[model samples]
Target: MKFLHLISIIISSIFLLNPAFGQTDQWPKRTIKFVVGFGPGGANDIVARIVAEGVSKQLGQPVIVENKPGAGSVLGADFVAKSPSDGYTFFVSAGGIITNPMIKKSMPYKEGDLVPVALLAVSPSIIVVPPDSTIKNLRDLIARAKDAKGIQFSTAGTGSTPHFVAEMLKVNAGGKYDIIPYKSGSEAKVAVLSNQVDATSESSAVTIPQIQGGKLRAIASTWNKRIEALPNVPTTKEEGYPQILIGHWAGLFAPKGTPNEILDKMNKAVEAALKSSEVQKRLVPQGIEPTPGSRASFVNFLNDERNRLAPIVQRANMRDD
Candidate 1:
């Protein structure tokens, strides 16, 4: 009895010291879910699905993506934040996750509720107009916006990256435009196609097909350099509004209290997925750049993103309503 008691004590100590030892070894005995805050077909959803497939393969388990789009992705984020931190449920979050709290009056989850797992990808916004519209370029669009009535700029919703783009135009270029909120980026693009709105700044991945199909005209790529998918389209910097730089980035996050070992494993899986050539082939043509980095790197990136967008959100007086 004494020898058995000693063995039990030593085993308990080992498990306590390395909690992940048993947990991670038996982890993911079931399917994993990646919850996305935006609707399907948007850049966030697209990236999530692509990476989910890769992670599923890497982990040798089924990884599925669930879209819970609403409140600028706050709803989906809230869902993931409150989910069990048992390494099965993760959030495929976008830049909005950081900016939403800064802009909204109240958030469902607190700052530390969800922790960064990895940075997945970054997609620059493209300022686009209908193919037949008279707004041929950024210059024309800015001039039109300065008119007394002002142009109507469509966006996914309040606190969204596209909304930031509209605000950036106002703050950096003196372009006055009334914002028109839509259900999603796809709807915003359709509104532009039908001339319901004058223009919209959307993820290059979401708008590149429309531009190539000649249904929309690219005015400016809102990044430092022109997009590879649309080489002829000049960047906002080249168009003289360098301050209007922003990108819609997606990252993975797990609920707080999740084991660091699980986070590290997921991060490695994501990094491996991003490095896959097939993933690159599918992502690069759409102007989506894969950005795989360590968990700490993702945390720093989120902090920087929040710092960069906080001022813009404040200056615009962005609100959930």
Candidate 2:
């Protein structure tokens, strides 16, 4: 009896001290769900699906991409923020999540509601004009905006990153511009294509097709460097408005209370997915560069981005209420 009691205590100690014990080890015993805050077939959804497939294979479990698009992605974000912290659910969204609270009057969740898991990819925003538009370049557009009513520009939404890019350009280039808000990036592109707006800013991946098809002329990229997909187009830096550098990114996040162990596993899974040949091949050509990193790095990146854009949002008095 004494020997049996000693063995039981020894087994309990091992289980308590070692993570190889049981609970976290059997973690993804079921399907993992990636909650995308955008509709299907869009940039966010497509990337989520690609990464999800690779992650599923890497973890030897089924990872599903579920779209919960609504309210400029706030709905999906809120859903994930309130989800169980069991590591089964994740929120994959654009950098807008960090900026939304600053720009909106009422947000469903605070910044601390979610924790960063991994940095998926970064895509720079491109300012484009229709093929026939007289606005030849960024300088020309600024010159036009310096006039009485200013130049008209359309974007995905009022408080979206594309809108912020336009606002940043207006502030740095010393001019005013009329902003027209559309429901989606596609609509903004259409506004420019139909000459309804003088210009529009969209993700490089989304605008590349139009630029390549000669439907739109690439003016400038809202990034520090020229986009490889559109090598001829200059960046905001080259255009002399380096302060306007802005790039949209997608990343994974979980509810704030999630376990660190699970977060680490998810980050590893995502990094492995990003490194796979399949993910790289699909992302690189579309101007979405994979940027996997540790949880600390991702958190720091988010903090830096939020700080950088807070001033812009405040200066413009931009609110999505």
Candidate 3:
């Protein structure tokens, strides 16, 4: 009986300690978690799902997107920032990540807590109004803002891209208007459609359908070139307002301290996914131009973007909670 007990212990110890005993090199033995800083059915969610589907197939593991929307996307971002620094947990963050720290004094995690995995894509903002809005174009909106008794604008949220755009427009257009912020771009769009507000800075994804359905009218796209999706709309620069270039972007990130091999493997998967014809085709119609680059390059770009926009964001006096 004593000899049998010793043999059983040895077998149990070997099974527990030696992975090579039966396991193969399955890198992703479980599902990967892709954390999105917004709810489902939005731009962030769409991009996360598209990339996750492709990456999951490539890695032979599921890449699930968990939404954590609130406090202008800080909730989801902080979740990813505080998550274990394993390749299994990733963040599909955007300009909101860098801007959040500047807007609020106390963020859950600093920007350095996150590491870039890849630069996924970008979508520019557009100025759109309700179908029946008397303010037909950018000039008219500016004029009304300056002359009207109580002009107001709607934003996705305070410190969001649209909020910054409206703030900057207030400064450059030389007019102070009432500011109302909603929880999401869709809410802001609804406000505009209902004529509760005058204008908004929204992505093509949010505005294009409304424009097509005659619920809203897109006056200008805030990109350097006319978006292929909205060919008829002119760029803000072409319309003579370069200051209207607020845009939205999405990228891949992992919490700092992620292993190098995992990052490399994940990045390769993202690169392949972004370049896939299906993603390109679907995204192009939504005004997103697919541009994939290296992790190092993405990190450098993030730092550069942070530096370049800090002064402007500071000047806007964006802040709090």
Candidate 4:
């Protein structure tokens, strides 16, 4: 009886000292959810679905995507930030996650509430107009914006990547346009397609198909290099607007205090999913680039991205409203 009691105490101690030995190891026994702060058909939704499918396969669990669109993705971010840190709920965050706090007067959840898990992918914003519109290029659009009536530019929201692009044009190129906010990039794209708005800067992942289908005309890719899917489209730098460079990047994040073991596992799963041929094939043509990196690297990347955009947001006087 004494020996048996000693063995029981040792086992209990091991589990207590390494709680992950039990909890983290058995994690995700049920369905896991990837929350997207945007509507369907947008870049965030598209990437989340693709990665969720792959992650489900890798983890042997049903990984699902749920959209909670509003307040520039704050709704979804807050939901995830407040969710249980049980390795079951993760956030598929865009650039807005970093810029929202910079622009918004108040955030429902603190930035530290969510911790980075992995950087998944990125897509440069593409300045596009309706196919039938007379705006030939970036310069033409800028020239048109100089008119007294100006032009209408649609965006997902005030702090979204498209909004930043629009602000960049106004500050750097002397372009003046009225920003029209929509629920999601998909809605903004529709506004441009139906001629409700003159143009929009949307993620290439969301705009490449429309451009290829002749529904929209690509004016410039908002990056240093030309998009692989739209090689003919000039970059903003080539169009003489070097300051207008930004892209929408998606990263996985979990509620703070999540076990490091679970975070590491999720990051590995994401990296594996990104390397799969199916994911690459689907993402590449959409102008999305897979970015697989460690959790620490993702944290560093986030810091760098925030630093880079802070000045732009300040100069543009961006606000959530």
Candidate 5:
């Protein structure tokens, strides 16, 4: 009896200290759900599916992509944040991942809502204008806005990164511009191309073809340096608007409370997927650079972003969602 009790205590200790003790038998027992906050056909969904494709094979399970877009991706984000942290549910988060909390005084989830699994990629935005517009470039656009009625820019909804990009530009230039919010980056780009709206900021991945096909004209990139795909374009930093910095990002996140062993496994799978030639081929050519950050590093990055943007968000008095 004494020996049996001692053995039982030892076994319990092993399970407590080590999650992988039985993971080989329990992990991925069923389909794993990969949740994306944006709709299908967009960058987030596209990246999520690509990562899922690789992870599914490695995990020996079907990794499914689920869309739950709404409230600037808060609906999906909130869902994942509150989900079981069992490593089954994951989030393909966007810029709103950090910006949303700063704008909302009573948001449902904090940075703790989800665990930063890895930084999948970083897709910088492009400052685009109407194809037929007289604004030849960033300088011309700023010059015109200096004399025109408030410029009208469109973005992927209010409280989004593009919206802030436009705001930051207008603020930096001391020019007045009213940003019109659309449902998606594609929609906003269409509005600009159709000449319905004045201008908008979008990723090179989505806007490069349009700019090349003469559908939209890219004035500048939001990053400090030019993207390889759009070698002709200059950076806002070079364009003399150093304060008007803008960048859109995407990353993988696991629901908070997920088992450490399972999270580790998932993180490894995602890292491998991002590093895979297939993923690099699909993303790099489109100018979506990868930001490969570790789970802890990403967590620290998120905290830093939240703090940096809180003051900007408050100063703008932005509440549009």
Candidate 6:
């Protein structure tokens, strides 16, 4: 009888110790941290906050956004890449994740250090000028750039998607337009708004408000399709410069080795958040389009992005250092 009892006890202990017993249980018991690579008010921050609200409700726990902005968003991305693989920590980053490695002499973390969780949004860049400037259309802008001695353009920063798009214009349009880099997209927008710079291609999120207020004019968009906020603006494709079709995108990622189950849960939560009406209502006007997708899909998207930009980076000889 003792032998039988011992056998039964062992079986019970084994069952209790089995990972499957508690695998799906008590997850997300504490607050989850969502790290943003950009400072407040940027497209990455805005998208993370909006999604955090929805994710918080979906997960029944608070989702906080911690901004560690700098190094063109590399600071925040590296933080998450080195963080514990527990599901509690996630990252919200922009296109810099792919672009940085292409240009920067070195990076603290490899691009593969983070696993793609979800793609949050795609924000097209807009080529804008101060309202009173004479540059009215994409063709005219290119012509003036080639004709003038010092046609200047500004972008959020070097290696940023906007910056690359500006470079694309210079290389593809075969113009001598000089690019002026700023610390942030807001600062770059200010340069164009104050006429400190002749033009700038900035995230539509940063330009839409001013465009609507008549402070700036939208001459062209980087998106293949016209953005709703700037309905009248032509696309780079429409302007005969399809090579400049680059824009900003936001996505979530977890540290490498993070359990696939955790990644899936976060992915589902983000999808739910993205589909929520609140997110749509808030982000669309800011020129952000929510792109909630699965882990595999996000990975494939990243791969495609790399392939698309590889030629641009190589041909332009763009480098961060």
Best by lDDT: 4
Prediction-by-prediction clash tally: 0, 0, 0, 0, 1, 0
Pairs clashing in candidate 5? 85-258
* Top-TM-score structure, candidate number: 1
Each model's lDDT comes to: 0.89, 0.86, 0.81, 0.90, 0.80, 0.86
Error (Å) of candidate 2 at residue 211 is 1.0
lDDT of 5: 0.80
lDDT digits (tens) for residues 1-321 of candidate 4? 999999999999987775456788777789999999988887788889999998988999999999998888899999999998778899999988999899989999999999999999889899999999989999899999998878899988778888888888998888578999897778898999999999999889878877998999999999778888998999999988888888888999999878998999999999999999989999988999888889999999999888889998888788765
Write one digit per residue (lDDT tens) for candidate 3, span 1-321: 999999999998986764334333455678999998888877777778887887888888888989988887888888988887656799998788888888887988888888889988778888888888888888887788888564688988868888877876776676767878898888988889898888888887667777888888888887778989888888878878776666788889888877677788888888888898988887888888776788888889788778867877778777766
Worst 10 residues of 3 by lDDT: 18-27
Judged by whole-model lDDT over C-alpha atoms, candidate 3 comes out at: 0.81
Between 1 and 4, whose lDDT is larger? 4
lDDT tens readout by residue for model 1, 132-153: 9999999999899888978899
Candidate 2's displacement at residue 39, Å, is 1.3
Per-residue alpha-carbon lDDT of model 6 for 161-182, expressed as tens digits? 7678777887888787788888
Which pairs in model 1 have colliding backbones?
none
Residue-level lDDT tens digits of model 2 in 1-321: 999999999999986765344567678888999999988866777778889998998899999999999888899999999987778899998877987787778988887898889988888888899899888898888888898878888988867877988889878887878888999888888999999898988887787888999999988998777777788899889978889887878899998877778889989989999999989998888877788889889889888898888888888888888
Stretches off by above 4 angstroms in model 1 are: 1-21
TM-score of each: 0.92, 0.91, 0.87, 0.88, 0.89, 0.91
